[model samples]
Target: MRIVVADDSFLLREGLQLLLAEAGHDVVASVADGPAFVAAMREHRPDVGIVDVRMPPSHTDEGLRAAVDVRREWPAARLMVLSQYVEVSYAEELLAAGEGGVGYLLKDRVSDLDDFLAGLSAVAQGGTALDPLVVRQLMARRPDPLAGLTPREREVLALMAEGRSNTAIAAAMVVTPGAVEKHTQRIFAKLGLLAGDDAAHRRVLAVVRYLRAAGG
Candidate 1:
């Protein structure tokens, strides 16, 4: 995949460039701040971009704001935002900006190279890849939407929010794939997601609803 690395830290920017290159992906552009990130996105039009949540001058939400701007100008642009901590509001804004092709991962996760690469790949393929910690924090913030779900179904929903596939959810929960499917179906029903809707779309909608209250 073609990509861009955006962060105020020179080390992080270069680290990501090198990491992506080693993974056999092209790092088309690397920039230091939000404005430069936006310009690089326009110039390179990479498949996905890796952006830090805080950058430059303010060190608060500039990169994320620029990501939102990119999505606004080019709806198809994909981005994976890395934050040092669990910033639910930032995740809300990033996810709310587009239907898919967006990710919010903690910086710590980068050390787990395999997981980080998988998350990046997921986002590039037009799928959501939310950090597990972010999902857990969001769940703790809001229990109202989950009132109708059973305990098992809730676990399923949490994994779904992490952008896990049914097989993955099953493995994580030590359950059968069919069991996971049933739980997901019930989650859809309780969430009022149309049964006829695209499965992937419904999954993203469910996660979006879960985070929607975070902004409030």
Candidate 2:
């Protein structure tokens, strides 16, 4: 897959280029700041863009804003945002764009190269990939919002918020896909999310509700 990387830190940018290149993915562009990142996106139109949430100048959400702009201009654009901190608001803003072709992961998670690549691939393939730590942080913030959920339902919901598919969640929870589906239905029911034919859309709505309830 063709990829573009954007980060203000020269070391991290070079490291990412090397890592992706060694992994057999083409690093079409590597940029340092948000504007340059946006330009690279327009020029390369890569299969996926990996970017740091903070970059250049103010170093406060510039890369994230650029990512959002690119998504608006090209809804099919796939992006994975990396951040040093677990910023739930940033995650919410990125996910608010809707389902698929998006990811939000903490920089520390990159040490697990296999997981990182998996998330990048998932985003490239029009799927969601959220960091587990981000989900955990959000869950810890608003206990009252989820008080109505059973423990099992909360587990399913947390996995769902992490952008896992039913099959993946089922495997993680050590249950059948059918059981996972039942838990998902219960989650939506309790959260008051409307049932619909478009499962992906409903999934996004569920995640948004989860974030909002968590005070994000």
Candidate 3:
């Protein structure tokens, strides 16, 4: 997969480039800032983009905002938002990209080379990959609307929160996708969330609810 690496930190940028290249993926452009990353994407249109959340020109969510814009123009392009810490809003926006090629992970996760590459691949193939830490933080923050749910139901809801389709969730749970759909319907019923809401609305609200309750 062709990729663009964007990070203000030289070491992190070079390290990611090397990692992706070593994994036999193309690192088409290694840029130091978000604007340049955007320009590189416009020029090369890489299959995936790995961007640090904090880049130049305010050094706060520039890369994240860039990712949002990139998706707006090129919705097919995959994206990975690399954050220094557990950034809930950034993760929420990126993962709320409707189960497409989207990922939100932490810098520490880069140390797990195989998992990191797997995450990129997941995004490249139009999947969602949220960092465990981000998930934990988010799970901690939202009030639990489904606290009354069974442990099994909670598991299904967590997967749903990750934007997994019913089929995908069922596959993960080794059950019929319809079963997963039923669990999802039950979860929403318990949470009082209406069915047929768009992915963004479902996800952001899910995050809000999870943080309120989990605190785990």
Candidate 4:
């Protein structure tokens, strides 16, 4: 599979290129930051991308997010996010896009060449892979807010945070206007949200919650 690497560390960047090359995969581009990663992907059009979760600028979820944007526009591309720390939250977002053709693993797991290669192969072939450590952390959580919701409800909330009103959310969710109102009420109650409280002004807080909350 043709691949691209995005990591701020030069050693890790170069090492990955050499290792993937040794495995007979082309390393089309190597970038040191999130913006550069995006540009490289557009320039090279690699089949798969390997990126560190925290790279450059905020050192937050830039890499993971860029991958998501790429996936939205290029549905066929495979993505794998690597991080040194065993963080469950990152894994959740990486898998949130879709289970197929995606992966999230701790960087330490790369030491096991056979196993690491297996993960790359899985993603390249439209399969899913998650580091065991990540799975363990995720299992510790009980209750999923997303569970048991109608597909329309899920889509509603996805755009709801964009500050859409009941009518707008209704249009986006493709349900009856009355149904959208009911679904929003259900979502607000389920998510512990309160209305008439100026919570709408907390959009940034909501963004971080969507991006950083552990099992939220």
Candidate 5:
């Protein structure tokens, strides 16, 4: 896989480059600031981009804004953002860009190389990989709409929001695929999401609803 890394921290940026290279992936470009990150994206068009939520200048949301710009200009760009804290608004903004190929993880997660790499891989393959902490924050912020759901239903919906497929959700929940499908249907109905023949579209709608209800 080809990757582009953007972070204001010199040590973290260099460490990521070395880490990806050691993992047999090509680090096409490593940049420091948001503008350079955008330029690298246009020039290299890497398979996946790993970006810090904050960058140079204000060290505020420069990297996140760059990610949004890249997504706008290049809709197919896959992005995995690392943040020091769980910001529901930022996660909402990132998810609002599209259905999949996006991730929002906390910086602490970087120490778990396997999980971090898996998240990037998932995003590159057109899937979502939100950090568990972010999910919990979102869930904790608003619980009214979800209050109507059964505990089992809530569990299934949470995994759906994480972009898990039915099979994956089933395996994780230790249930059969048919049971997973049934739970998904109930979730959609309870959430008032329109029933559709397109599975992916329905899944996206469900996730969007989940995020919105969670104060995203």
Candidate 6:
């Protein structure tokens, strides 16, 4: 996969480039700060973009805002945010922007290199890869939207937010696919997602609802 690495830290930018190169992916552009990241993204249009939440000049949300801009310009852009802090509002905004190939992972929580690579691959393939910590923070911040769900239903919802398919969720839970489907239906129904909604639409809707409930 061709990629772009964007971060304010020189070491991190080089480290990610090296890691991606060793993993058989091309780092087409390595940039520091947000505007350059956006320019590189427009020029390279990489398969996936890895970015930190903060960047130079502001050290606030430059990279995140850049990701939003990139997504706005190219709706199909695949982006994965690597940040030390959750930055809840923008993270929610990023997730709610669109459904395809989006991820937000905490830098410290990514202890397993293989798992991190797998998550990146998942996002590049138009799937989600929400970090469990991010999910937990969102859930902890809001309780009203998910009030109707049972514990089991909530478990299924969390996995759904992580972009896991029913088969994968079933394997993780050691349950059958049919059982996973039933739980998913229950989740959708409780979340007010109509049965007539397309499956993928409903799934993303359900996950977005969880994120939207997370207060800014």
lDDT for 134 (candidate 5)? 80
Q: Which residue pairs of candidate 5 clash?
A: none
- Candidate 5 residue-wise lDDT, 1-216, digit = tens: 999999999999999999998889999999999999999999999998988988989998999889988888998899999999866676666776766788888988789998888888888877778887887888787654767789999899889777667998999999999999999998888877767556666776677667777773
Compared with the true structure, what per-residue lDDT tens digits does model 1 show for residues 15-53?
888888899999988899999999999999999999998
RMSD of candidates 1 onward, in order: 2.0, 2.9, 5.4, 12.8, 2.8, 2.6
Order of models, best TM-score first: 1, 6, 5, 2, 3, 4
Give all TM-scores, in the order shown.
Answer: 0.89, 0.81, 0.71, 0.62, 0.82, 0.85
Candidate 1 Cα lDDT to native: 0.85
Error of 3 at 115 (Å): 0.6
For 73-122, candidate 4 gives per-residue lDDT tens digits of 66667888898765565566555554256777888888998878878886
111-172 in candidate 2: lDDT tens per residue?
99998998898789777778988877766776647787898988887888777889999999
Model 5 residue 183 lDDT? 95
| Reference-based lDDT, residue 195, model 6 | 90
TM-score of candidate 4 on Cα atoms, chains taken together: 0.62
For model 6, how many clashes?
0
- Judged by whole-model lDDT over C-alpha atoms, candidate 4 comes out at 0.68
Model 4, position 15, has a per-residue lDDT of: 92
- Top-TM-score structure, candidate number: 1
Candidate 6, residues 87-164: lDDT per residue as tens digits?
877777788776658889989745677878888997897777898888887767766466788988888988988878
lDDT of each: 0.85, 0.84, 0.75, 0.68, 0.84, 0.86
The lDDT of model 3 is 0.75
lDDT of 1 at 137: 78
- Counting clashing residue pairs in each candidate, in order, gives 0, 0, 11, 0, 0, 0
- Give the best candidate by lDDT: 6
How much is 175 displaced in model 3, in angstroms? 11
